[model samples]
Target: MERFIETLMYRSRWLLAPIYLGLSLAVLALGIMFFRELFHLIVEIPTIAEANMVLMVLSLIDLAMVGGLLVMVMMSGYENFVSQLDIAEDEEKLNWLGKMDSSSLKAKIAASIVAISSIHLLKVFMGVKNYDDMQLMWYVLIHMTFVASAFAMGYLDKITKH
Candidate 1:
């Protein structure tokens, strides 16, 4: 009975497989949105102001960053928690595929979030006339919070490693 229970517990890690698959589906959805934005930018180029177009391009960059974050999380999370990925010897492999552990994954996620937040803050600043003073202050505060959190995480990880 003890052996059976251990086997069952070990195999249960497969439960995470579906969640990783779901992230892939989300990537597909984001790709569709990205192309839609690209098409809109091309069609509206003549009518839109230069600043507005820049903001639109920034949105595309934000989406790409998010998609990258998702892929990293899904792949790394699966490898860390579920099981090692089996790949063909002849297939091209990603350099970072099996290297990122949980701690590194967390750091990458934090950095990505800070980057996305910076882009968002820039867009808000570019259109400052649309936001009141309070709104602008809140945006800056929120971005600062992300920066502080990421810094603390890095510091803690460094000290722990030593």
Candidate 2:
């Protein structure tokens, strides 16, 4: 019975394999969404509608940034936690893959969030005529909160690593 249990534990490491692969599938879904957004933007280009075009452009940028963030996290997290990706010697490889451990990954994620937030804030500012001053202030505050939280998290993580 003990040997059987040991075998189970040994094989369970591979169970993580599937979970990591699922992350790739999620990445695929994000790609689909990204392209859909892109096509929508293209379709709307000729309408010359009253909608805030600048804000809409910022929104598209924000979505692309988010897609990038998802790809980084999904691929890097899988590589860090599950297995090293076997990129062939002659093939192009991700420069930062395997190099970014969880700590670095957190920092990258934080920075990405800040970038995405900045885009969102810009969108809000561009649409300022439609939004009240209070709503704009809240948007700015929420983004600042996210910035502060990310800073604190990176600092604490750094302290622990040493």
Candidate 3:
């Protein structure tokens, strides 16, 4: 019975496979939204003010960063938690695909979150009139918190590795 239970527990890792596939679907949705935003930007380019154009471009960048984060998380989480992906040697492959372990993936995620937050904060600053002073303060505070957390995590990870 003990041996059977161990086998069951080990095989349960497959349960996460579906969840990772869901993340791919999310990436697809993000792609659709990105193209939708791009279409809007292109359509409005002639009449759009320079500030508004900048804000729109920033928004697109934010979406792209988010999409990249999602892909990274999905692929790395799958590889770390589930079975290794089988890829042909002749096909195009991501350089970091099989190389990222969970620790490195976490660090990358933290850094990506900070970057995404920075872009968001920039967008908010570009349209400062839309937000009050309190909101602006909260945005900066929240972004700072992300920065601090990522830094602390990296520091701890480094110390732990030594």
Candidate 4:
């Protein structure tokens, strides 16, 4: 029974294989969405007023953040469960790849969440006239919570490592 359980545990890693492939598909989807947004921005260039242009730029920034999140998940997930990418010493490499274990990945994800939240917060700020004070305060509070959580996690990780 013990031997059988060990084999099952070992084989569980293969389950992650499908998840990684799914993430690849999701990445492709994000690419299509990004390009779709890009085309819209191009078409709306002349018609979009200056104020709306800011909103359009924010949309682009949101897409960029999502893309970054996808890349981080895909690369780190592959390295952690699947296999190390055969990136060479001289090859152009993302600095954070391979170095981020699950713990670091969690922290990075938390930080990214905070960043994306900030972008949203900015949008709210820009549209303050449309938002009630109570709603605006809640958005600020939620963003602060994310920031605090990320900082606490990073501090804890640092302390535990040493």
Alpha-carbon TM-score of each model against the true structure: 0.95, 0.79, 0.98, 0.89
- Residue range 7-100, candidate 3, lDDT tens digits: 9999999999999999999999999999999999999999999999999999899999999999999988988999888889999889999999
Number of the top-ranking candidate, with TM-score as the measure: 3
The weakest ten consecutive residues by lDDT in model 1 span 78-87
RMSD of each: 1.2, 2.9, 0.8, 1.9
Clashing pairs in 4: none
The reply for model 4, stretches above 4 Å from the true place, is 87-92
Clashing pairs in 3: none
Clashing pairs in 1: none
| Ranked by TM-score, top first | 3, 1, 4, 2
- Cα miss at 7, model 4 (Å)? 2.1
lDDT ranking of the models: 1, 3, 4, 2
Angstrom error of the Cα, residue 139, model 3: value is: 0.4
**Cα RMSD (Å) between model 2 and the true structure?**
2.9
Q: Summarize candidate 4's per-residue lDDT along 24-117 as a digit string, tens digits.
A: 7887887888788888889999898876778778877887887788789888988897778898789999988879998899898998999899
**Candidate 2 lDDT tens digits, 107-159:** 98999999999888887776688899899889999999989989998899979
Q: State model 3's lDDT.
A: 0.95
Model 4 per-residue lDDT at 78: 83
1 or 4, greater by TM-score: 1
What is the overall TM-score of model 2 with all chains considered together? 0.79
Error of 4 at 122 (Å): 0.7
